[model samples]
Target: MPTLPHRLLHRLRLPALLLTAALSLPTAAAPATPAQRLADIATRAYDDQARFDPLSATGVGDHRFDDQLPLSHAPAERARRFAAWRGYLKELAGVPVAALSPADRLTRELLVRSLQDRLALAPFPEHLLPLEHMSAVPVQLAVWASGQGEQPLRTVAQHEAFLKRLAGLPAWCAQAQANLREGMRRGVVQSEPVVRALLPLLADLAQPDLARNPLAAAARALDTPPAGLPVADAARLAAAYRTEVAERSVPALQALHALLQGEYLAAAARRPGVGWGSLPQGAAWYRQLVRDQTTTALTPAQVHQLGLREVARIQAEITRVAPQLGFTGDPLRDGGLLAWTRTDPRFRPFKTEAEVLDAYRAIDARVTPQLPRLFGKRPTRPLDIRAEPEFTRATASDHYGLSEDDGRPAGVFWAVIPDPTAYSVVGMGALFLHEGQPGHHFHTALQLEMPLPEFRRRTWINAYGEGWALYAETLGHELGLYTDPVVYVGQLRAEISRAGRLVVDTGLHAQGWSRERAMAYWRDVTGAGAAQAANQIDRYLAWPGQALGYKVGALKIQELRRRAEQQLGAKFNLAAFHDQVLGEGSLPLAVLERRIDAWIATQRR
Candidate 1:
């Protein structure tokens, strides 16, 4: 039986005490620092982009919109996206970099540069030339549905979602065709060779066989039930998937192929040049592409000169290695070291595909023992090597495809084995290093594992990533894998090829070099096989300025390492220097320099 006064006192006592404690504490919580605010902006920007670019979202392992596919190549839609980029750039510009922490400043610079590059090329007619080997929408969809790409097909929901995406193919291809039609009107179409190359690719997609049709293959491949799902449920889902794919996706692909072969191919034949310079506003467009890819102001001419210097330097190295291999043949003669070594039976050690794969595996195993000595951190995911799929084998470049950290799909290092019976094993070690351990696999997987912001984790600056891989190729020498003279020559030739890309890529697009001239120069300099020369030249035409990133990035990294070694002297730890370079995943070459400079300053202190 408590009185009113007693009850009131009990309730008020707690409230009164709490009020006194609050009053004694600080008046208001401190506002977020400028760096924190900028970080928030980055997070928001990534989320916004993920929503807009569903394909990118899937690639980053964000399954929020696994079923959605954007008609990004549609001219009006593309304009809208560009407008949003401008708005984002404006907001980013308002941020005060001077007030940010060093790390935050780097982040701000990266985002700013990324936006600026996108904005710089926004007005260009890239959409007109969208369907290239590097990023063909039709091929990409089939690849996605086939369960070989980033698209997930493990769950019943995922499989259904993929069907929806597959269904979107007709609309996407129609938009692409419309864009190409506009390009034809404007004389901004792709080269004849590039257009002709698409025929075989289209034929592969038009296969009637359900087991062979890439889209249908995705559904048929679902032979087992996903976890927790009954066998009947899985079977039902697969059957439904096959129906949509056969009836919908297959027809769409056939229609698109018809459009390409009948209309697009004829149009391309009427106008043919490997260079974008052949189009309206071509020179300016080429310059902008250079800026976008390299993130530097160096002109195509300057890049050409740099390439010449590197070619001579690497050629000299190759010549030095030639005499040691008992091949007295002139290294720079018409055939050179490349011709002799490639023809020599001793260099072609692998008689079978299994043996070739084993060599790469051995390279991985050999390099694994030495990784700790050069790198402080190693990616948890092991690199899985596989033969490139038949559909893409002709046009496919050897590359590294990253996997999710969840550990289901191991990162793949695709080795494009064209002639299995007589594949040359000259530079397999360096190639392995570039595409596998300590190169792409290390740079990409480590980035995924890092405690980085979402954008930083996923952002791929071409120069930084490619340069790191090229630099990784050099590490094979230090790791004792390049002990053989022939292997050393192989490494030198690979370096020369990268250097030659600088010369040849610019020659084709910027210097007004004809396709014939470019191919001739490639043969004269690197003595590359005719097939190799043609494949690479087509790649450059399809993807302008991309080839420049490798040499530019590698040279910058080599310079930084040289500077670090000089400044730190006895204090410079190779492992620590490598850790800093790869610690932040990929960076623009400029940001990388700033980061390395900061590390250098810290070491000096």
Candidate 2:
């Protein structure tokens, strides 16, 4: 449930433009071997990608572009980025893959597939339709500007660089307005609900009170000098910040607020329907979205059917545990025990936000001691739990935020409980397992600390990333953390929720299902509250094909684990298998299969 950075999208689509300087490196006299060629390409690609994506660069501890936010919404910029992708594809196509080692070959295959995914999206007008409820630019920049995100604000120079970058907000917002208008002209705007969700967030940003405004508060914090810094210098920087925010940031955000509330929302409201099928060439675009997100060719009908089967399977398991939790009834009648478990007051355990966080901390404590039994390795970065920022907590759910490679900040597990008393404890264990331990923190922290290719550490493929977390959800049983019957049911409920994703995601995007229908189906299958169901459906609308990754990736991992255990028999080590998966970092599900297969072969020998 970690929010994907907006710059990651930039990295995928605009990795080429940043490479203009990188591609100018001198050619070797003789053709290099495949290993050397791949190594060189990865190094160059990471450098160039960071150049195009300064925000991402800052996330990974690169400070070179700390003072810049490029005008990415301009048409000219998109054209340049598209051209760069083609040029890099051509360069990659020339590499002789037949001569490379297996590991190098895997990296080549992944790099090429990633480039193709980026190119596949270029023929469409998605660049114009950039803002979404899940990762809107206005919300993300506020987070960064508040010094709560990847942007560094430790040193005086860092703060000055941020101020310079902050000064560019007017131009950036102007470009966004222009692009949104273009998208409206092209009939490619986001859904109405997604656009409407932006209204309140932007309103909060445009608030006049500096104390209430997240961005202004970040600037105001500069009033206090850090460590040995002079008070006069800090005071001077603070004044400059307020001046820039008044003259630049506030007006830009106000303009953005007007555009969203007036033009964009009206246009999107007039659209025929929320699904991609309503737009021009939307059917083909949705198909491509499925392919890119899942990295598979399975049709919508196929994924939907698979979801039906998985949902039923997980429900049966939940029913089996129902009796143990003191819910006795006809085993399979009208959602049976699952529905009872959801509505029963016994399941609603938390009375306050502190209580919810304490439960999460307890879950983490219970899992930590058992972690070594399940894996050969663990992340060096310590994990901390915190409540989500109140401003965005309504839209945000429980998620894990990663730390920088330098380890200046430890990774955090964020729980957003809007109404603490109403918080359901049914899936708390599975959620913590997925978002906290051996899930995101486990996957991301190890990648940062590992001595792998920079690309591998930073790659943000959703299917592989989210899928691994979902897979980790199932590990609660193996790790001895799902001891209580209620906790085990929570795990089952979590799995069913993921299974619903495969169905509802494909149903909404590819099958022409309405938003209302998707919500209905989600409620029936998962027993989620109205707000929870509505929020998830809007997220799927905002990000087509993304929800499919969780189930697809988890199923693939589970399938591979079964295959490994069956093949190696007694020799199969769960810890080694897990290490093989996590140690390589995030991969496309296809690449993951190949890696696991290779490991299974080695174990057989």
Top model by TM-score, which number?
A: 2
Q: Which residues of candidate 1, in runs, are more than 4 Å off?
A: 1-33, 223-229, 404-409
TM-scores for every candidate against the unseen true structure: 0.91, 0.92
The runs of at least 3 residues in candidate 2 whose Cα sits more than 4 Å from the true structure, single-residue gaps closed, are 1-34, 224-229, 328-345, 404-407
- Tens digit of per-residue lDDT, candidate 1, span 1-605: 00001001111000000010111111254236767667766776666666556665566566777777667677766676666667777767777888988778878877887666767776677777767665476776666666666666767677788777777777777777787788888988888778777777877777667787766766676666646656886788789877876787677778878878888888777764668788788889888877766767889999999999999998888878888888787889875988777667777767677778888888788888889999889888677887665667787788877443233746778788877656777878788888888888888788878887787887777778788989999997789978887677778878888999999989988878887888888877877778878888888877778889889999999999999999999999999999999988778788789889999999999
What's the CA error at residue 456 for candidate 1, in Å?
0.6
Error of 2 at 518 (Å): 1.2
Which TM-score value belongs to model 1? Answer: 0.91
> How big is the positional error of residue 331 in model 1, measured in Å on the Cα after superposition?
1.7
Global local distance difference test of model 1: 0.74
lDDT per residue for candidate 2 within 446-517, as digits (tens), equals 877778677777777777878889999989889776788878888887888788888888887778888899
CA lDDT of every candidate: 0.74, 0.75
Shift of residue 465 alpha carbon in model 1, Å: 0.6
